[model samples]
Target chain A: MTRATLLTITAPTGTPAEGDAGFALADFDAPQVRITDLSVTRGDGVFETIAVIDGHPQALEPHLARLAHSAQLLDLPEPAAAVWREAVAAGVRDYRERNGEAGSGELFAKLIYTRGVEGSGRPSGWIFVDEGEDFSAQRRGIRVVTLDRGLRHDVAESAPWLLAGAKTLSYAVNRAAQREAVRRGADDVIFLSSDGYALEGPTSNVILLADGVVRTPQTDQGILAGTTQAAVFAFFEERGLATEYREITADELRDADALWLVSSVRMAAPVTDLDGREYPVDAELTAELNRYLLSRTE
Target chain B: MTRATLLTITAPTGTPAEGDAGFALADFDAPQVRITDLSVTRGDGVFETIAVIDGHPQALEPHLARLAHSAQLLDLPEPAAAVWREAVAAGVRDYRERNGEAGSGELFAKLIYTRGVEGSGRPSGWIFVDEGEDFSAQRRGIRVVTLDRGLRHDVAESAPWLLAGAKTLSYAVNRAAQREAVRRGADDVIFLSSDGYALEGPTSNVILLADGVVRTPQTDQGILAGTTQAAVFAFFEERGLATEYREITADELRDADALWLVSSVRMAAPVTDLDGREYPVDAELTAELNRYLLSRTE
Candidate 1:
């Protein structure tokens, strides 16, 4: 295993593998995909990133469910959850066993399933487990800016063809928005719909704290349902605070007492400033949330 | 070469190659891209497809210029046009030589330039020349349906981060619209902006003729500036017809005397029916236009 452990899904769908793990480990550093793969040529694919803490993949079931939902949205064949589940476990175990003490801390397993090479009528999938970037600075706090997502919040229901909420690989616009955020002297971005409603970030969900209650933009509004956000809500509920999901206006988001962008790998990163407005970061509470997030075994 | 000729651009940019074509012939069957390449993972890339007819690549310079323009929109390093131009020629020649008499008809050279493997500053470039699908039935006529693009027409100017006109690999939305069209009993689609303005098709440009004037939706409205549409205008201009570029409403498009979906591979595909309404197919005129389009030498 050269730094990372990679596996190509031999049986992405159909009956689960009994003796086998439904995948075959392959070279991680060598070229592994054809130039004509739809994922590369047309961005026709779905993906998920699962954070592995001490050989345990956090939110594994939710991530797999979202992957199936996204595949259905793209008209792709539903991936076999059992196969992917086993593949993720095998990938994490392989990476940990090969890296000795180096990989015991934090790692991410990325699962990519795509419409295969053109005209082949077959799908392709793979899982790669490797160390993730250090989010220490961003995990503490980061500056944020609001950018237009260029689609109405209702597009998910009105025009499903836009693939608003799917975790597809066609993320060029989302990547561009982050670049724009950097250009504007901010470290992150929260996208606002064309109809003037707060959505999610490029890769995370937005959460707000106000008036002793916690709120997040609903998943129906052309935004992804974050896996880490579920855990965050569980944290707040355990602390006796109320949590809700609804359509949030930009003005309401601005008036929140505290805010954070939560995702699978980075967990929770408190927002220190949104646009030009400053907010007080709840350092102690955020630290506790991250600590709880890292301690999840299943 | 195996059904196609593939070339890897070893030096995609910088000083142009003198002794070499700036590319190397590669195996078309082998996997050529890493799993982490941004093109596969994030759809962070731009591409262009040029038509090749009997050893001649039509509108090569214009296609290269558009490719450069799209790269600029994505903030990618400008591709050395001279290097790509030579690569296309080599790829076409190689394909023809390998296929002999079988490749005398129509071929396409697809130029793909991507933000290379993750964490590596180097970009990736490749060209593949292959025979296109037979378009005899589609050339006669295609049934089209209007679908919402879910973006305002002015997003190209107002929200550059949307990457509306850049022709990036993030084309899943466009692909989904075509699938939706098929579901609606149509063979193709013409996307309408959220503001009710006529826009381009999923893989082609929409051209309309009415009252002796040839018109197309202006490219500034978040639509690709079409290379084939330019040649279509030239065909009409030679026959003493005026051509115009302006924002066209959906009603105007529906009432046109004639319409076509022009593209690189298919050239000119006449539209006979739109949204259950019928238009008389001008087979002779469409055939003449395609002949002229195929006759371009440069």
Candidate 2:
């Protein structure tokens, strides 16, 4: 009989998981926390996906800044900066020990922060690390489907008090939307808010095209102002391309010269198809953005 | 120096927390689980609250029946009968161990059924033993505020793909609305669906009075049909009083004869004030309804 090896790490000291004294162990190969312990309460928490580059997290500072902003939106306690830095460092360490360096392909690090524990205040959180898909897919661009199954941006805009831009744990709906898209034989989905407004993609950022200008949803549209989205805007500005962040209707998407889904993993995957309509992939622009992202990380 | 004693519980098998693990524990005091471990992704859970009568959960059967109906709505795996028995047994056990038969006053019991673990394929769930509240405030009635927040009922109705009428985990907005209400010096809130239709209360059942008839928000409004509200309906029906479950407007609430909030904990808390407007408390009907609920529990 073969025995499986386990890797574990002690949960953060102040976390309620630490309250379970018996389950605490000292190791690093397996996760110390188990998924079953989660309850179905409001599931309010903040999370961020960091890129691991050359045994270190790329753009770590910006991710943390967004995480903090999201925590504030959710009314959750902000973990100490040192604690977040340490968690990210630990994840990077694990990645390096297990998979060597960033040259061995890109690693997607996910940091989850939640607070639903007994002693852990209502703002308890967790940080996790993960490796993203290889850049091979983005090398040839990707296909996408526009889905209208999620919340509308306007209603979400009206009720600004809720966790609008925050990366809360109430992500089951988002994940379900992605699953629906994948089920439809597409690589990803760009959610159209309930009112037929083009929102962001399920897990990635969104950018559209209209009348020779690059456009994306306004930040106030309840879409997460993604880090990669910001980088794209910056690149567009530096290159002197007219970048606009405004409300783009589904009708506008049909006439746009090009559309792309941007994220840390893919940098920018030009949309080849949307809602059964196909657009010519902008390979040259995609390569330029990917090169810019890689130049920063490398 | 005196030390404060902290009460905690751990799973019997010392299992680590699992994501999507919804139901399993029957006892809160046996050190089985933590509350925050529950998330909203599990659609197969239902809860009931009853006036603890003689150290026991009241209206256990009806509450169980409603829970079974809810589980069915979410396509839960457990049959109504089995889930009810487990809930009753757990409630009884919890009361016996935590509150004890010798105690007076009142207690509250909650039964939550969740789709346990990601792969169990069978819905996992549980019964929670907790404390109830004092009803002195209800006698005086309450001050409520009105707000139209998040997804309105019509949008939810159109988006039938989203879980409707299931006491699922997506309650962050609901709880936040309640918090906002309390912050504004109101005891509770009556949500106006996006279409300007009056909906239900956050934690309590809704009751509206107009034309000498007692009417509550329709179940089709996508509100969790309150078990206590149902009992009140039955009470009024037997007494030859007019009762209904239908669509109502906020304008209707202003002109209604009386509006009350119902729940297992508070029974029926009358709306004495709404949005700066005051209404006389209906003590006569409240007393009658209280008697009816007590009689049913007995």
Candidate 3:
């Protein structure tokens, strides 16, 4: 398998003037980030990961929009969307050409935009595409636990500095929650707002099915607006399953008819169990959703 | 007059047993970190910054202990204290050697320990020292503002995954809060817990003097145990003032007779104003305290 490909945006915050390439290919294995980059020093940055199926990057625009939204939340400069989009396309093309166009391996493109080296006003951006991990087992089913996120649901409005809705590089707590889930013998986690409402997972959005209606926790409660979740809802809508984005309490989540954690890289990971409570998986429907997700070209 | 000095720990998590050289000098201006380093991607790491004055690194042991403490909070493997300590010494030695030994610059050494490149399973460590910013004005006095931290004071106890107390690299919120302070036309910020208790500053600890007692927000409330704060307390105790660690509320902080934000690099910055309300600066006492802090050889 070919290793990952890397591209560094020469101008991350705006369009490149004439004569500026905007981006260039770089060595992926060698070090490319300065120790002083805010992304390394303070976790001061935004990022997006998009899944590529059959050489098509899924939900590219939504991912880019979210990346911009996250940057706005952090008060960072507006990202040069065209430059980043072109970089992703180039990264994918380079990877496919290297791996052979016939190889239809699932890949992921991670976009990183960081506050550059300390004391430098310039921001930094990078994009890299690599073969995705086998989430086959998780796609079919996975176990999860609920953990307290320790912030009130209204904090998003009450305290923007808390950076709740931003998909920032500062994900240590999310990583820790996932580790806590592993400690409890689970594969993932569903975080709860301190006010007793289900928030989102460390890296995924929570989707619940109840009374034939599908619902996911509202993003206004400081949770991310999942790119894959929108598609998941579309999938359900096509199947005549009503979908929603509303606040789902922890208790309501526990009582749901079914549940899944959705994200770009993993698509739809059905939660087979949550907090020791078992939930049956809809194998056929889940497979169809996966097929539908992989079939998307946008 | 010189740029920063850097030392990369060859082995970050253990004793450099059997002549491993433990650490080596690295080019400071070069890119020494990979984009995949968790410190860059996930902010999955811990760090410490210790002040050095006239060749002596202040509170060396306390800084090391706190680094280890922060690491444990993140479930990261125990850091190699001996190796780290030696690296700090080498860094200081290198700086003093290059610059004149008689040059008494206020330098700060930053220790960064991160979960290494993805899937490498190895940790990374580095130490860099540079002349501190000209905080002479801030040391004299500075304006401040209050922002909500969004997490209740008890979350550190109720929710370990929130990672309140750890000195992790996940500082996006802190950076955002600092920017918010700037937007509010203030020099810095003091974050209050959602439940209306004074927490700490984004980068410094809050020390309040009230009713003849010197107080600070308790560390149990998910605040870092400030190495410089301990010295501040000692400064107070020596002058026949009672020092305390208690849950100071927002109103109590406002009512305090005097206040200062203390940290390693900045030393002590007396808050001249809070939310536009003026507070008298004790210039004489502040200078003496800073003098005592700088003169320390331990």
Candidate 4:
């Protein structure tokens, strides 16, 4: 008798991850399939980047919870948690298998759950995984550009009814701004809203320096509330360093003592420059946050 | 001497063949390796969607011209035109061999020129040919939702940036908005600026109702300016009906006599409903435009 050869890819010892966070190509059969599927095929979806440390995806629960909220805001079906945990665990496993060791460097875990595949004739959803960039710059800090690409802020307040808090993909504009910043010889971009307010970074989280307290845009600014940003803020609160969330103008960012682009991937990187001018950082805070994060990981 | 036989098995075409537009996907065993070989993988890329009609890709010249313009905008190194024409022709020939008879529906030919795929380690551009929606409703019309989905007008005007016009694969937000509308039981969506000013539809073109005149948002409104929308405008002008491009508001749309969603695939479909309210159409004007489009195509 022929033996039944079964290939069983056991579920990893974790939860299924979900988001429009990972990468996929834009190839779909029917164009309308994209409309109906509302999947990532049209390259329109928002995502958040989270860091994986040791054997665990850092801030996994908060990230997943926020992803659910984002999906709901975007009017997509809330993906089951088992699927999300599995997807993320798979990503972590794949990273460990190929890279062989977690090392001191972080492993990036992006949980991409698109709405559907184009012309797949199926209700769309897929979990994708990929490696992320080297965020060593977080330790050393990085240069950035404050670009007046004329993004608007009042639109967020007036049209709070829109997908303000949802991290939907339509990011070609953000990517373009980053490229424009690169063309101007900057490493990253900070988009300036039309009213001269400082918006978020292209892909990183945002924090600013005003007076003495560190402040970032409130959740209502239509910005994706970053898990890392939230985590770091909690860390600050524990340390008794005051932090605030409020509207900030470009002048504030330009004149602040220090500005950090925070994210799960970036952790926190101080911006040393904006446009063509340079801004010096307060070295004490940089070391303080890095130490706090490293200690927490330990 | 033994003759070498060439194997010609069936390939699943992504879309139906029409005007020589069709496509089939081929998987690479080691996608990571192939990406390095294909120069088109550059993340910053541009594309043009051309319609295929009656075994011939209509608007070939215009499509290529637009491709060149998009390439220039992205600073992509353009391959020779002769090479492009030949590549497109080969794609068409392959489609013709498979479909057997002339196709009755619209075919969408997408030419992708990219900077390079991230981590693909390849230098390649991709050509995606697929089919699209059959606008059987153009003979009737469509229902649409006017949504203030947080798009801004000034940002589109002052910067007039590339992402606003370039047909990039980064379309997650546009797709998300459409899905949001769908959940609300609408067929499609038209985005309004945060200020309640009209922008454009998610994928289709835009034409607004007015004092017995058909108007579209100025190209400055960051609309894609569909070829069909242009054709309808030309037809109206030829018939001595006034057509103009200017700013429009949601209130204006509600006050107009009729509205339309236009595209290359659907041609023009009257928007019979906005939000949940019913909108009546002018049977006479709808018929006149339909006749004009048919005659022009013939």
**What are the fnat scores of the candidates, in the order listed?**
0.84, 0.20, 0.91, 0.27
lDDT by residue (B1-298, candidate 2, tens digit) is 1111111112211232664122244323232322223243222244445566555567767666776665555545444454345445555554556544433455556555555444335444444554455686775699999877556676445643345565655455566677678888998888877667788887776788788798887888678778788888888888888898888887997788788888887778888999989988868878878877766544
Candidate 3 chain A weakest ten by summed lDDT = A96-105
lDDT of 2 by residue, A142-233 (tens): 77887664456765557655566766655545654555667788788887776788888866878876676778888787888888888888
Candidate 1 residue pairs that clash: none
Give the alpha carbon lDDT tens digit for every residue of A1-298 in model 4.
Answer: 1111111112211232464322223221111122222232254333445576665677778777887777676555665666566566765565466555432345555544444444443233333233456666655667788766443676555644345556654455566777677787877887766677777887766787667687887766667778778777887778777998888888777778778888776677888877666778777877778666644441
TM-score of candidate 2's A chain against the true A chain: 0.82
TM-score of chain B of 2: 0.79
Over 4 Å off, model 1:
A16-20, B16-20
Candidate 3 per-residue lDDT, tens place, A76-166, comes to: 9999888998989999998888888533779999999998988899999999999999999999999999999988998889889999999
Q: Give the range of the ten consecutive residues with the poorest summed lDDT in model 1 chain A.
A: A13-22
The true-versus-predicted C-alpha distance at residue B134 of model 3, in Å, is 0.4
Give the TM-score of chain A in candidate 4. Answer: 0.77
DockQ of each: 0.89, 0.21, 0.91, 0.25
Tens digit of per-residue lDDT, candidate 4, span B1-298:
1111111111111222454323233331112112111121112455566666654565666667666665555555553454455556555555556555533345555565544434443223444444555566655867778776554665544554435655665565566667667777778888877677787887777787678687998876666656778788888888778998988888887777778887655567888888867778877878778766644432
The window of 10 residues in a row where model 1 chain B has the poorest summed lDDT is B13-22
Best-to-worst DockQ order: 3, 1, 4, 2
Tens digit per residue, CA lDDT, model 3, B65-101? 9999999989989998889998998999898787774
**Quality of model 1 by C-alpha lDDT:** 0.92
